[model samples]
Target: MVPDGLALPDDLEGSRNCGLVALSVVARCSYAEAVRAYTDVFRSAYQRHPRKNWKGGTTWSLVVKAMASLGVQHSHTEVTSAVTLQRLAQFTRRDALYLVCTTGHAQVVKNGWVIDQRGAVPVEQHWGRRKRVTAFHAIKED
Candidate 1:
């Protein structure tokens, strides 16, 4: 399961904030809270709301720092392109949690399901099935 209430809230409108949405779902926080956490990392408070004035770019380093701010234990890794989103599930332990980043998007994968802007879906059926995994993080579940 994708975890209860992990889906992006309807109010989020879900655009240009893939990293923020993924962070919100993984940390089980409100979309507003995620925005706060993310902007706090780089002191970009002026553009707190993605829909309003978000700059629309989050690097892997920013994700790491933001996760830390939220007290979400995580570790980052760079992987080969051979590890497509589908292949990622194959190598992932069934009990592990991950925030998989592709060329320009992110998703939360756990227990063989992926939760993103569109809600939860099996890894194979995910919209980014063939998206090459650029980098990924192992999120320690509490």
Candidate 2:
């Protein structure tokens, strides 16, 4: 699903940092840079300690704001339909970037490639097994 030279060359994966890692890949930045950007947005948008709710999983709002902080534009509207990740394209543009959020998880989608803590892979090989995507943040094209 990923084109040549598209996946993060040195992805910094975390046990519970799928959201951060996805942001890192989609923003095309280092994991450290993604963290810093997320921290800035987390402070302003969430107004609470970063990772205070991490155990509960990162919120879609935090992910979207972090993208904006890194200059990756996205649509603020959150589609709450319960669709599987594979069916995401039904609601979002096929060639766009998005922060696809499941009930308690988040991953980055770009041109049908799913980027998570495990790195970029075909959306089918993603955190598999019928992920009912609860939210979708379509990154706007310039």
Which candidate has the highest TM-score of all?
1
Q: Taking the tens digit of each residue's C-alpha lDDT, what string does model 1 give over 1-142?
A: 4654346754576463788888887787877888788878756544565565437677767777888899999878899547788888788876778898987889888777888877789888998988889898888877
Using lDDT as the measure, the top candidate is: 1
Measured on C-alpha atoms, candidate 2 has an lDDT of 0.69
- Give per-model TM-scores: 0.82, 0.76
To one decimal, what is the Cα RMSD in angstroms of model 2 from the true structure?
Answer: 3.4
What is the lDDT for 116 in model 1?
Answer: 80
Q: What local lDDT score does residue 97 receive in model 1, on the 0 to 100 scale?
A: 80
Alpha-carbon local distance difference test for all models: 0.78, 0.69
**With candidate 2 superimposed using the best TM-score fit, by how many Å does residue 22's alpha carbon deviate from the native?**
1.3
Task: State, as a TM-score between 0 and 1, how close model 2 is to the true structure.
Answer: 0.76
lDDT of 2 by residue, 41-101 (tens): 6667656655544342456677777888889876655555567887784455657787777
Clashing pairs in 2: none
Stretches of candidate 2 off by over 4 Å are 4-6, 9-16, 45-57, 90-92
